[model samples]
Target: MTQHRIRNKNLGLAELIAIALGGMVGGGIFTILGISVSMIGSLTPIAIVIGGLIAALAAYSYVKLGLYYRDEGATYSFFKKIYPNSHFSASAIGWFIIFGYISTLALYAYTFSSYAISSTDFANNIWIRKGIAIAVIGVFTLINIWSVNGMGKIEDLMVYTKLVVLTIISVVLMQHGTSSFGTFIDNMALDAEKSNIFSVLIVASLTFVAYEGFQLIINAVNEMTNPEKNIPRAIYSAISLAILIYVVISLGALFAIPTEEIIKNKEYALASGAGNVLGKLGTNLVILGAILATSSAISGTIFGASRQMSVIASDGYFPHWLAIRKNNSPQNAIVGMAVMASVLILIGGLELILEFGSITFLLVSLLMAVANFKIRDKTASSTFLTALSIVCLGIGAILILYYEFTTKWEQMMAIIILYLILAVGAWVYSKKNEMKGKSS
Candidate 1:
């Protein structure tokens, strides 16, 4: 039987929210803060709000499509079922979404390791950090392979606990920061004058990846209870909470930490700033919060994305063996995802992974918006909102691409080459599935 056949509907509203929050809040603030602050300076919080709003727009289509189809495969399955005739489209979305998850998985783990090792003498050793990153991915993979319910409970603890730690960290930073509240406002005004609107928008677009995890809620449709009500409730609530946490913490980081310090210590920027502002005690707290955040995110991503991987594999877009499950979990797919993410951690630079993940999700989410717009009547979606989501998400994706082309053309070319490789893989697999159909 398919894994969906054994659904116990054990995931409730809280667990679902934890999963979504776990996915979104993971290492997002920790990594994005430095980059966003470097670009927009004191306007980082505003850019974060814009990014969160963009994510909300993306979530609208996901929620509508999710409820309409009730498919756990989510992005790929939604597109595939909506346009069943388009095997290549299904295959391509499957490849893109899975790899997107892989990139984020690597991102979170790398961030986790960066913080985990920051307090140690081995802080500057990249190899050790990467090794630890791979090791953490292995730990979460085993947790996910163990039990869905177990993972959910752990996620609840990690996500909720981190929220508290994070809030406290932000408050403490602000209270002890060199920059006063008035100074913060003045700096923001200064940044407004210095940074172009386009630069702020580009940073906002980059932050979209930080919000990519809410749709992860839909990936748990089979495991979740009351899909009709709980899906919308859990996802919307998670996104709202994420926005609040991101804004507060980002504002704290920007206020307390010098802009140059954050920019210079991009890998563990939050902790570095905490060290200078709040000293050892505060630095430890930030590191602990970051570790928890990234750990839960890694776990949540593995739990949600592996299911999609198996579904795609079952449909012949991936190796069929990955579809095989034990104890209602796609064990092989989980292992496959872990191995791949570890490989990425070993090779992928922080910036490259960040850019790859941001671009992939923005493009994929834009596709979801387009697909939702096509079936607005059936999904009960708002015409104006959906159209606006399309326009804004399109601009979000374009802004990132434009920024890369203008400044980082080589990186853009690398991303382009990666896309070409994925497209070719999709074609090959789709062809294999087609030939299998004929042979059978």
Candidate 2:
């Protein structure tokens, strides 16, 4: 009935950081590696760092509004309370954010499948990967529908374990990397000469998906103490750690594996290439790390996003059936969310899903910046930082749109049509709520 999980201030700063880091450092790095390398080559690290900065800027508004609102519903809840009279605006935000989660869900599962398929005999079988991705989504959907409270604890372990595994993978690859540090820099220098700033910026914009899960910290407001102190600390610390982790892993890969190999492998780049360079032991380590990273990412996304979906439904912005619950779980929303994600994996390729998710979150976070600006006084937000968030996030969205328009117009159009569909759905629900409000 409540917008958030039961209130319990048991999570400390360390736990808070883990939760935010867990939400973030998930499938993002795994999904973006090959694409970023392909687009920017040895300059991927620079683009990744820029992307991290962009995430930091977005976090400013979230932290400000989060502390002011102190509501666990987060993005949706913020908009709803802030624009209490604008049913359409609130409804649209809820719809956008929920679907945004769905896009990321598909990204994670697809990435998982890519890595899962890499070690198999049918590595090139697209249909088999799709099948595995859908099946994994189905499994998680059942666990959610069945209401497995214990999964949360397991998710925490996956988070910590994956971090260690990734670190080990990074170190191993760096140790056994075929290329020298000097060669790596020379390659980067060569890349810089060949590529323009726009290329790196575009890649940076695309990599924003890797930095998204930081907002999960606010969702735990009810479970953390000293909101004023812990919120910013946890979010900022987690983002910094994520940036470090990503930079290290990416640089290690660039040094250890060739650019063509990474680009060629695409989805399963790390695992596939690590075998040739780091041998069987190293390759297996990367696969295990990728699996844990993506698996937890998928589970966490479904759980958090489904809860938000249920809340949106309860508020009448989504299908009423999605509000149905069993054993305190949003069974209908869970199933509906799973079905949509599986459909996405079916139709869209990995890059399409990745770009769509990055764009959606960028747009949503930009909206949050605008909302924060409107209530700067109440939230005590810095006008300069808020404007920076708006400007930077707006540009990031534009850059992604620009890339898609020029190189992948078909995907661009698909994204636009999807938005059109979501907008109409959000509007219809908001309209229904208005009519019901007047009749009562």
Candidate 3:
């Protein structure tokens, strides 16, 4: 089949905002909050705020790169333009990001299925749940493939809806929450004394998952309107709003639910907390909100991952066929990402997917931070921010890697294996293409 070229266009502020918000608000907020509270007790809000700061630092690095590079491949292009020796490393890092995003899609798909079942009785049937999850992925893939613009609009709406839902829940819970100042102080006291510093670090790393969406804006920098300015604006705005929402929700849950219940039953703490404050309907509303949150995340993730493949293929790292666009969308990349994500859903399930994806994403953030440094040597501006970025990312990466090895060795290994395979695949493909060009 003849290959078609995929073109890039400038995306506007609104589009960038939609992509960032959509990417960031997924399954992590709805699900990870409960698990995080279990690990750090009432200090969960503090942990989330810390994670947000690290994420903001990383986002600043991207903004610096985005302003200088303004290329289609985002981090890949940034590293390639600034540190030619590390092109392969940058590409591999980008591949890890691709895998990370796909794994995120898998997690959201699973979460969507679980929430669907819990919200409605029909999801109890195993086959039904699997079918529904797969179908959701399929529908989202189709939407993205049909039109990137359409998907952008959908994501914009989803972001708004999720923010509103979470805000309402947080406000209600905060108003009705009954924890005494003494109880709050006591909970913090116990956490500080009983919990290991390392354990809090590990739990805090999970909160970083909530910050994942902001990077999605970078993937489509070429399509963004005035990316030089809007990219940073979108990143800062989305992350700031997300952090505020997370803190309120976390604090609300802490105050509304007993510490013992939250620690023991991490999976449904939010629902239980809502039930305590707002009754059955309140709990149901949170579930419905989760559905929106997960589904939006899943959809936005599919869009971002597919576009990454398209960008890579356009750069000649993959077969040109993968870059072919139909109706302003990368059809093959969309399908390929969907299939890979679906297989991961089947193999690792949701929990492993989240852990694996988080590890890969943390590593990529580190690479991007380094890329910022590499670029600063080439350009004179933004040196201070770039240096700050490197330090913050280095500290976060160390914490995340330490936690992964200690608490999640198996999933960390799985991420390593997958990354190696992608690296080798990219290398082999480049060599074969070089040979073909020589022969011709």
Question: Mind sharing the TM-score for model 2?
Answer: 0.91
lDDT per residue for candidate 3 within 26-133, as digits (tens), equals: 778756676777677887888888888889988877777777776656766676666665445555655667777888888788777877788677856777777777
What's each prediction's TM-score? 0.96, 0.91, 0.90
Tell how far residue 28 is off in model 3, in angstroms.
Answer: 1.2
**With candidate 3 superimposed using the best TM-score fit, by how many Å does residue 266's alpha carbon deviate from the native?**
2.9
| Model 1, span 1-440: residue lDDT tens | 55565556789999999999999998767667888888889998899999999998999999999999988899999899889888899999999889989999998999889889887899889999999999999999999988888999999999999999989988878888889999999998999999999999999998887888898899898888788999999988999999999898987787788888888876477777678877898889988998999999999999999999999999999999999998678999999999999998877676776777778899999999999999999999999999999999999989989988998999888888888999999999999988988899
lDDT of 2 by residue, 237-273 (tens): 9889889889989977887887888888665667765
Candidate with top TM-score is 1
If both were scored by TM-score, which would come out higher, candidate 2 or candidate 3?
2
Clashes of 2: 0
Q: Candidate 3, which segments miss by more than 4 Å at Cα?
A: 1-11, 85-87, 196-199, 377-381, 433-440
Model 2, global lDDT: 0.82
**Pairs of colliding residues, candidate 2:** none
